[model samples]
Target: MIESWVINDDSPVPVSSAGVVEALRSRIDSGQLETWLTSSSGRLLAFVTNAERAMVVLLEGEGGPGEHAVDPGAAGSSDGFVLSNGQGDEYPDEDTVPIREAFRLVEHIVGTGSWPADARWVVDR
Candidate 1:
């Protein structure tokens, strides 16, 4: 797993549901998370906080949503958990870099204002 920290507040002020959805869809389709896939059977798990301050974790794999209703504190201070299968490696530990990278991408594409100040990404094995 890899993760990094990104601080951006460029454009796209006050992220909306549509914006969040679009960001997620784009990231998924952009081949950005391919390196993080756990395996051929592995998947990407995205946990996000909604505009209503409700938390939802959506698995980008086959089985569909596994959990819901997770509180992520304030609305704009949104933080997310991204699970990336480590696949088979000499290392087996959780990394939070990917989370940072994902946040950076979102922040860049979304402009900035919509980006949360406390937004962080964490990757787990």
Candidate 2:
């Protein structure tokens, strides 16, 4: 597992739910996250189960119904996080960084309002 002090110091970035859902859908369809995030401007947020079998990403699209809700149709691995834009899609963990690490990175990016291609991860608190 990876932990970073930055994650603790940073708060989640608010984003548009529609945009985040669409981006995740693309990730599922193309089996890539980084490529999809290229145009996303870092407005996305993700949550993963400890088992890493399931996760949910949200767009801080304020005051919208189901902004954080996933459509029933767009789903991921039964052993992986499920996301469907009401369209068929899946995840490729081969390119998926650790979920918590991704979470921290995002928190830092959003909190600082700066995007870093790579971040330092550590195991020690």
Candidate 3:
């Protein structure tokens, strides 16, 4: 199980189901744009957003492949969506989901320490 989560590289806090959900909600509601959840086991879930669209990336271990939740039917003419931090990072529009979905994904990973099988994922090679 996940022992704790760090928000935006801040000091770590004990992980609780409600805490995780509230953190995500507060981030979105406040338009923080960039927040990261790091598990005690070294797993990292990076959340970046443009307010309406968000990306949740799951990294399993040190140098392990990263998996991203994707919206299978989302189509766009542009190359990808940009999620700006210091230097901007881009993810395919299809790889971005609604903020609510991001909340669900983060909650599942934090609560169970595993990915939810219901969503489509693109794994890094």
Top candidate on lDDT is: 3
The lDDT values for all models are 0.32, 0.35, 0.72
Global Cα RMSD, each model: 14.7, 14.7, 2.8
Ranking by TM-score: 3, 2, 1
lDDT of 2 by residue, 1-125 (tens): 22211111123443332244343344545643222121133233444332333333333322222122122333334343433223323454432345545544445543453334464322111
Q: Give the range of the ten consecutive residues with the poorest summed lDDT in model 3.
A: 77-86
State the TM-score for model 3: 0.79
Candidate 3, residues 57-85, lDDT tens digits: the string is 88876578898888898886222233434
Off by over 4 Å in 2: 1-79, 84-89, 120-125
Name the candidate, 1 or 3, with the larger TM-score value.
3
TM-score of candidate 1 relative to the true fold: 0.23
Candidate ranking under lDDT, highest first, comes to 3, 2, 1
- After superposition, candidate 1 runs with Cα above 4 Å error: 1-13, 32-55, 58-125
The positional error of residue 55 in candidate 1, measured at the CA in angstroms, is 10
